[model samples]
Target: MDYEISLETLLQHLGEEEPFPYGSVTPPIVQTSLFTARTLRERNTQQGRNEFGYTYTRVDNPTVRLVEQKIAALEGTEDALCFGSGMAAIASAFLTFTESGAHVICVATAYTPTRMLLESLLVRYGVQVTFVSGECIEEFAEAILPNTRLIYLESPSSLYFRLQDLRAVSQLARAHGIITMCDNSWATPIFQNPHALGIDIVLHSASKFLGGHSDLLAGVVAGRKEHLEPVRRTRELLGGVLDPLAGWLLLRGLRTLSLRMERAHKSGLKVAEWLAAQPQAAKVHHPGLPTHPQHALAQAQMRGYSSLFSFETHPIQEEQAYAFADRLRLFRFGCSWGGYESLLLGWAQTESDANGKASWLFRIYVGLENPDDLIRDLQGAIDALTP
Candidate 1:
């Protein structure tokens, strides 16, 4: 059965072919802290081999390796590593390339915790980080230092859904001998293939769309085998290996990812378009919308859109923002999204926004719910903003 298959087929069957003692369709979780090596010589031989012949769970786990392979295949990379959490994967990726006094340039609109990791932790450890508007390739160029080791980006960025020119930035980084990493969580592997655009590493918060249930927390980094070895070593040292149960759950989620993402793509665009027509919404920040400033870039770069997007309301007081969020009945007021349930989150301003005023900015995640239902929920909530 050696044949190329579509991603849709790959997702369903890529990692499920392990030979179990019984004829179970799904791979059984080797839920143990350590595996028996059979003999010292065998143990040494297994340790010497690069394949995931598990000596310790912290080093590798069969369940985790299966998901890692699935993710790597999905990302069109040579190898991939899974971590206990998204931040763990992110930290390991950064720490692998950066030493004390190393310089890095990060996109300004990256995830809040990612910025914190760079500004709060990495800075304290003597790493220099410059936050730049990735929307402008020139900012990345101007911020690069002789010692710049990494350029971190999150396209259709965390808050505003702003996009960076991945190919352009990657080419620029290549010329400078700098490695480039991008958080592909927003678009997921389904939509954007950063590696195809020449990115060095592609990272994902598997807890989002990959898990699709919000029940597990995991992260993945996919790239060439050589580039991932250092991150694997760092993950070992940091003890951030995802548990077998979580790995299995993530694999289960992957089975339906194509379906979920397709539904989200349609519903997200429908909702974003409907929101734009509403008087309350000053602007919609979805890349799928023709009105988005970087719509053309997104169209060229991404194969599809994700469920997540943001919208700005006509200037409203802070209380009104809270009231609108509270009024939402169908949309859950929660933090993370990409699950079966719709979510709504309101923020005064993102870290990149300098104004820091009390304005209504709502980030929406359209889920598997019917688009009309989500729209009605949003419309009702917006209606609350009136007087």
Candidate 2:
């Protein structure tokens, strides 16, 4: 729970010794479909035993449980469950919390897939949802209805890096007896803990920061045991359990999480500051920078910043924006981030705004690259944009 001492130390050693065999430094993969008990009675009662009483890998496994425990500790939760993908975890949470005719309030800028899930899928199930700007707690308050069952948040949202007042929204949800869930992939546990800020559940696309490398796909949900029991049941019934190898990779990723995050935080701020100074960059949307609208709120809630952030460029043609991205040497054109390599994604509004100008927006993920070198790469791209 204590971010400084306990969490940092837990990442290094938590659950490693007990799950591993013969004092193996790294935990074993536990790569098997089933585990047999010595007696019929034991096999019959495995479900009643503790969480580690693994009857099948789909239900539980030592390797996956180890990763779950580490994430639970890192997020300061009573327990956690791992899933095959981020959307699987999100779907399980949404499925477990709401029933037909229930109403939900979600941030407008949550992950695109999550929005699609709510808009495209859940609506078919008779669930109603309202999307709010999330910058103002009043928007969530005003959107709440008598049938509202949940409120979803994504602070420092993926594209704009906009932040919501977690504590404020949590308090509002508690007053309404509504459950609160947060997508914390943007600010990994190393930077922010939504549960500690009063959120009921914390979700992550472990494929990003948690995996550290782009080699694995996994998701995690962490909260109190009671709140997570239903989710765990949903996970089991849905069959979205993480595979053994990905769990092993996540275990390896956890070891260096702290070091990687520290580098990302510093480098991200440096690059954002430089971008803010550029004439072509209309605005930089990094919470770590004081220029950010919610910088003070971010400081009060999060101990650190993530590498991913977005910025708006002075009005430019869509082709020119693409040209700038194509010119970058260090930052790759990719959809995912929080890995070893920097990435760039650019888009422009198809229709002009009230001012009859369409500004291009770009999301940048500052990786483990040297700040100076990345900056030069960006400068080169900017210089070549007009040509």
TM-score of each: 0.94, 0.95
> What does candidate 1's lDDT look like per residue over 57-125, in tens digits?
898888888899899989999999999989999999999999998999998889999999999999999
Off by over 4 Å in 2: 1-5, 45-52, 350-357, 385-387
Model 2, span 288-318: residue lDDT tens: 9998999999999998998898888776666
All models: lDDT?
0.89, 0.89
Instruction: Count residue pairs with overlapping backbones in model 2.
Output: 0
In model 2, the clashing pairs are: none
